[model samples]
Target: MTDTAEAKRSGPNSPQTAFTWRHAGLAAEFATATDGTLRLVRLDRPGSTQRGGAVDARSHDTVAPETALPLVELTALGHGSGWSGPRFTGTAFGTRLAYRGHDSGSRAGWEWLTVELHDPATGLTAFVELTSPTGLPVLRSRVRLRNQGAEPLTVQSVSSLLLGGLPSPDTLHVHRARNDWLAECRWYTEPLRDTVADIHVDAHQHDSRAALALTGRGSWPTDGHLPMGALTERDGGGRTWLWQIESPAGWRWDLGERAHGTYLALNGPTDAEHQWRFHLAPGGELTTVPVALALGSGLDDAMGALTSYRRAVRRPHPDHTALPVVFNDYMNTLMGDPTTEKLLPLIDAAADAGAEYFCIDSGWYDDDTEGWWDSVGAWLPSPRRFPDGGLRAVLDRIRERGMVPGLWLEPEVVGVRSPIASALPPEAFFQRDGVRLTEQGRHQLDLRHPAARAHLDKTVDRIVGDWGVGYLKLDYNIVVDPGTCAPGDLAPGAGLLGHAHAYLDWLFGVLDRHPGLVIENCASGGMRMDGATLAVSQLQSTSDQQDPLLFPPIAAAAPTAVPPEQGAVWAYPQPGYDDDLITFTLGGALLGRVHLSGHLNRMSKHQLGLVRDAVSTYKTIRADLARAVPFWPLGLPGWTDAWLALGMRVPGGASYVSVWRRGGESELSMPVQHLAGGEVRTEILHPSAPDAGTAIWDGDGGGLRVALPRTPGALLIRLTQGAENDHR
Candidate 1:
């Protein structure tokens, strides 16, 4: 069969299939309805028979125009009539768009399919582009709009992707994650029927106007909710659709019952939600943010596919392959109060514990005796903190001990009291009504300005080039809501979107200048965790929760949104903690990037030995993490669960599991169904203490029974199937 197949129309008013394309085991069909609207009629496995024919027949008999949604839903001012029902759906211009043509081809490592549509009334053209990695059951989509008419157009909302013809609402379950400052990546599942109430569509002959919508506001894309969701069949059919929107600015998604089945719409920013508007001149064009959709038999399978897609799209860097252990002086240790006297011993201790990079986080640039919170624009080291030879002396010591040196930097914000705030022109800062906007005593920088970009470039060159720093922790601590608007922009959200694009370009330029340096993305920790930011940065700080007892859930759920190798989980073992407590904290980071912290120099010999052992074990298995996919044996974790298990399925049918016991019974059972009916061997990789914990493998039942004698204990276990050599 050919790669692309085109079907001709049979009659003027008769329903006809327009196109059918197949790739990576999935088939997509586009059909023209009786009213001449091009709709995405079906998306399913290649060999599977259609499941909702009878329902679709009934839907056509009742409401022919609402059977399926168009390829793209666009809302523009003064171009189309007003829409009824929900705010973003059923736009007159979108429904009346005429399909021009479609083409398919391969470029680089991706296979792409583009469908073109034209708005005859306004002379607007939209190219809906869909691409996927070769042989991956994942599709990413975005829309490019060009204004070819005489009059200018102001677009209010445009969907990146619209998927229709899903399973019946009564048979589906929706999953979403809620994120906060201390609590992050907490997922919950609900029935789709509950969200979109049944309004007797057959009796009323029209679909419901309400929708189950989720929106993220402000510059922090993932501040309130993650830009991801999934819909799985409640019955035993085992079909799931998991999706993510790739944007670092405002984003919104909605799903509701249509005439034939449920439909999903994913978008970057809309006027109703984020006050965003885009003005297109006669020759101007705009491209929407990209969104990805993966199909699988279950949630885990879909997540694994998404993991592969993420790796395929990310910027190539050595940090992903090396998986080096980094030690930062912040969490529960220096607490952002770093000095030469305080960092010397910690640097030596970190180097002895198998750490390859040491970072001096925050408070390093406090030349004033007063507080440093409102006066942190100058990226220079404090002379008062390092009296003798300056901060360079401490960095030299770190390098002398066979470790790379790093520093903490918040590049997008200038403190209100900073001299740079006044030195730079008003255009360099984010301003509204000719006044700079301040949040938490810090002014946001408009990276779209040349002066602002130049300032950051000079700072990065001096630190990474002249100072020889090899790593940077880029942190953003303020939230600039609605965002900043210039004179011609329609709204603040539009300017914010422009700045987001500029910021990403600036990041690429910095990496081009310093290719070897590693950058870690942080926003008070995990606030800005999205695909766009993660694709450019090497690592992501998962959270800032200082309490070890409350961190296991965050660490366990990090991989669902972030790849294991890129999610930096902190393991801070303090001096006052016992051996079991130390193991508990260290175990949380074994499967992911080990962000080691705490004052190891203050610990005794045995405590230090435990830290060293964890680092060594991580080094042995870190190579496997680059190719591994994560799984949860006991399901997505609860915030206060007694026991939590996170596993990584590596190549050669081997897996590594990290189990944490916070409270309740010491004995717990977790099901690893994939390894069932196979002979398996389990070994404790860390602590090596014979009495720390015991794990019994049940090959027949595909379960692992763990017994930890203490209330707060943890274990890192490696499970290998039937005669496979242990990679570690």
Candidate 2:
């Protein structure tokens, strides 16, 4: 009975079995062995903090605490797993280290019945290791996922790295760049209560807050902020990721479990569509996602040591956090099922108005899209609606109009009436009683099967190669799909999500082949705007907040707006609505993607001018603003409201700040601290206001406060060095 046992399933009365553990070289790293587990303490550098914060216009008090990572907590980390089915009972080598994991349990999915060994790092790296796939230490971890569930199962799962100890006044919040859909922050605030209340993920500032009974409730990915300070060790700076592996349905989750008030999480592929459904023969082995953990640091000086920790071995330094935003001009809804002929004028006008992309939407291909679920997988334009030359002619027209052509595809899904459904090998679909069930406006297509993958790949080649599509809008809305979890490899309980992840994997693979080709993921709006989708596309439409006229202000005001750091970080103001009001409201959303959502032709001349000017102004600050950080005066009284100041600090150069006002007052002064520091001067250039000037103020010591006029609550201030004052 050594710490490293070679035990196996004893058949209730047989010999004990143990998993194998292998260790490699290490200089000063500590390796502690417990009853059946090992801990690799990676000593590293202290955490780093976000340097800047938004300044004030009315009063420039001390800045709010920027992001910080305290070091003392770095020693905290763990690894273990709850047994949904059978887990390894013996010691096993994973991520180059040796550990143990238990197997078999009730409520099998969330069961922690058996034991689990771990080589948990200080929240710096997830213990994503199975037995080595290569040989010993240089690279690899090979392990297996055993499914014990009845019926065919597919396993698609997502795990988050949880960290605590955060910046006050603001718990960690991450919003979709567009909608008010908030995602669960890895950190739980209410000390763990389980109540499902709706918190806006990509919400307007006024709508982002939600009261969740933190303990028992797992908020939907679109209702809460990203939990900040969830690192296992001290926090300052470090990187983490969510990872997953899919089977056709049954699977197990591994994690470290000790109740000393620590942290854990799953990063990287946030919503990889990996649910629990895998169609596994009882006691059968399924494709495993055993050890797909994160790598990062909290120990400042130990960076070099941690960097060479081996687990991060040949992994690429990928940018997983933020994605770019896109603006699409073509409206896609059926709009009461208008005919293409009736829509041509509107579509043509949108293209002429400088729309970044012009899509034919749903009606372009046929007269009836209400039954669109039937039209999918057809891959051809209907003759009834598309008269003489459809897609080809449209492509030519779009290119001539100077805009990229984007086409929509739902490869992971198929319509019951789609011609290809009957053509597809029966294995390509999710079957129940010889019939495939459709859910949420679509039917699921399993992605784990090679045949399925091959089919999808071919479709992309044909569509992109033949149609000359610039962008691919991958709309995923399947709710009952038994997604691909490797051929015959299903997770334990993945219902529709299992197929979802496999489907995403398939699409991402296709995207990889098309260089410079951007993807627009729409899980019926913002449902699929997970990290996986974010990694593949420039931007994702946060929601179906498509009505330009009514949704502009609401779009601009949702609370779960943007990640504090990236784009779509604020609310997006839809077009039309109230041009001036929308102008002022769009202040906070300089980061992430912001696109128009209504008919441009309907706008009055003034509205059109307003939009053109707004877009122009956005271009002017495109480098600094567009998708950068802007500010809103929170905690202010209503009506007697104030203007929002958009400022950019130019490194070693002049900084520009734009103020958009909506509330009364012909004028108001804003503090200019977000701009370049040092001895600087301010100049006001209000294009519409007659009163303006280059005012010389003490810009040092105090923040840069500018006086802005009414109507637009607009003010543009440029900060430049007053001279060569070396003292900052």
Candidate 3:
């Protein structure tokens, strides 16, 4: 059934080529090939800065170096050519790197280099890239290695590359960790109201290694590698699959839909973790990461990308949406004190006063004993907390008001104080001494075990089915061992001792069962947020501290921790002047999800009114805000202004803008591409302050002009018809 090389090569017209050095002493070249569809490269010698002397090319085996040293600089390139060989010439950078191009049919080319190092034990790397005849990047790479001195060495490394691709909006990011069909692991936002975009969409496959990955869009809820949508073959056999790898390498991504930039990076794994992490002796050590960027249509295309690059190219994918705005309220406050008599009224008031979603937090259980990680799976009413009891009755009460009902659960967790742990054998624990430690406070559940599997199934089935919970905010204050865990189940990228991926698989499975259900995956507050797990949850807890001031740091760091889809942010705003409210909501909106855990009933009547109005205004433009093009308007020319004008433009050029004034005077303008490069009339309006109401005709200068009062915040503006399409 396998086709011979000749048979496989016949369908397409291939290119032929070899390497030529234009500037000799400056750079040395070794291998090269060109075919319109295939390219190969190897550098026997590169620039002084590049690294490459002895390398291990064996598929899954380690190799050793012979002497005390090896040149770190080296690179090569290959491509499919129209003719067969020798029509490509190259340019060299000193004696360090070189690049070549063909003057004929093929419109592709490459540049290679051997990056050097100061410390011998540190590491070495190579940089390579793909270019268009017009000189735009199609792909780029950063290959690396560990200099083991004169001895053998082993290590784990990851390559981080940056690409410029399509902009991110309301898109999906998949999780690419391990899968444990048996474990009841799942994902969601840690903070109930902070950020809710961590929602991980399962491709419905149970193969842990075959899950979705984050595309690292915007900065919020989380950072590092956030999840993106899943990738199946361009066909049905399930041969080719793809996922995104995201990071903050300081590159801005703003490509329109049909993105057509050069490929940035495309490297594969040296070992299972997409890298090599090892050691070095008195004279030995190695450190490096290889990134890769690849594309193919068949199943083989997917597998082949993971293979072959074990020792070659390394690249990072482009970035996406980086929103930082969020909504906040006293979500889990009810959980703090489950006494329904006093809490229900408060929950209702909060819901009415403009809170996005009311979180029916914890504390409804019968136990004063329900603290921390204790009492995990006892999904029942605490006779002591609500003596009159009916959890559904309370949930129904909330939903009747036209707002969604969000409930909190810990499916992957079980407390020792609860009946579930005492019911199961203590031997089922993850081992403290040998008997498996079961603290009187909390007993950990081994998700990788069959016993835990059955337990989670029963719990999730009921909580999700019978309860009809829309948002499941699950928390794991403590890390649970993912069992002895199967292969490909380590905390990806980090390769930490915990079976992180195995747990991720279980989480996705549960998400697949509940329709319209949002999963909030959290780790002891700020812990567990990374490239792997972020992609699989709707939202994750960025931090446990809910202070208003802490927001900026979270927003700043968010871009580096998780992708935009999971960029939900949890904030506890200080209730004061409407300025803080405007500031909090506006800032949070710029980031991700926003949440609150304070008393909503205690606010001033004016504050409540303001909230009611903000929520109404927010809903009016929710659709436009949710899926609009994000463009930020600059503040006034000087003096510490807080009011911000965030505008979103639609395809045909219609625009929606929201402005929040903090302290200083507010005056700002936005420029648009509407009006076919000509002039048009503009008008602005706001319920809280002055309404410039439909007015004069002027060109598309500084968007619609806006002005705000000192304390009254949150101004909204809309732009309709404009100039020509090809006027510019």
Please tell me which predicted candidate would have the highest lDDT against the true structure: 1
User: Over the stretch 1-728, how does candidate 2's per-residue lDDT look in tens digits?
Assistant: 11222323211122222221323211111122322223322311122132111111112222211111110111101222222222121111222222333333222111111223323321111232322212111111223344333443232322222211122212222111222333211122222112212343335332212222111111123322221121222233332212222211222222221111112222212122223333335465533332222222311112112212221222121111222223343443334243446445545655544455554444344545466656577566666665657657666766776767766666677777676777778777665545555555445666666776787888888778777887776665544432333344333134334554566566567656775666665655554434333434544555554432233233233222222222232222344356445454343343324454345556576655555554445445545432232233221112223444444444445565555555456444555544325566555432322342223345453455444444544445556767532111
CA displacement after TM-score superposition, residue 677 of candidate 1 (Å): 1.7
Ranking by TM-score: 1, 2, 3
Point out the higher-scoring one by TM-score: 1 or 2.
1
Pairs clashing within candidate 1: none
- Give lDDT per model, in order: 0.85, 0.37, 0.38
Write one digit per residue (lDDT tens) for candidate 1, span 1-728.
11444322222233453666666555666776655566777665555442321124223221233467788888888654344656356777777677777677666777677877787778888888888887677889999999988989999889998877665688889999998998999999999989799888999887787789999989888998899999887876667788999998999999888764788889998888888999999989999999998887778878888998999999999999899999999999999889899999999999999899999999999887779888988799999899979999999999999999999999999989999999999899888888889898999999999999999999999999999999999999989889898767788999998898899999999999999999999998999999999999999988999999999999999998899999999999999998889989998999999999999999999899999999999999999999899889999999999999999998575699999998889888889877877777888897677788888886666788888888688888899876433222
Model 2 bad stretches (over 4 Å): 1-36, 40-261, 265-348, 432-435, 481-487, 490-501, 546-578, 582-590, 604-606, 623-728
Tell me, by TM-score, which candidate is best. 1
Whichever of 1 and 2 has more lDDT, that candidate is 1
Each candidate's TM vs. the true structure?
0.95, 0.58, 0.52
Kindly list the per-residue Cα lDDT of model 3 for residues 1-728, writing each as its tens digit. 00211111111222332332212111222231221211222211223222111112222111111111122222211111222211111111112212122221122233333322222322222223222111111122343444424544333222333222211212212113211111111122111112113223244221111111122211111223232112222113231123233221111111111111111122222232222223334354232322323322332232223222211121211111222222223332343565667667656765776664556655655465536456556677666666564667666766676555676665655676678877766544454334453444566565556676667768777776887666666665543221222233222222212324445667767766764566665554544554345555666566554444334434323423333234455534334535445444434433334454445566666656655654455445544433343434441111123544444555455565555555565554444433335554343433453331222323535345555544434444566665422110
Query: For residue 519, what is the lDDT in candidate 1?
Result: 97
> Where does model 1 exceed 4 Å of error?
1-17, 47-66, 79-83, 723-728
Candidate numbers sorted by lDDT from highest down: 1, 3, 2
Question: How many clashes (backbone atoms < 3 Å, residues ≥3 apart in a chain or on different chains) does model 3 have?
Answer: 156
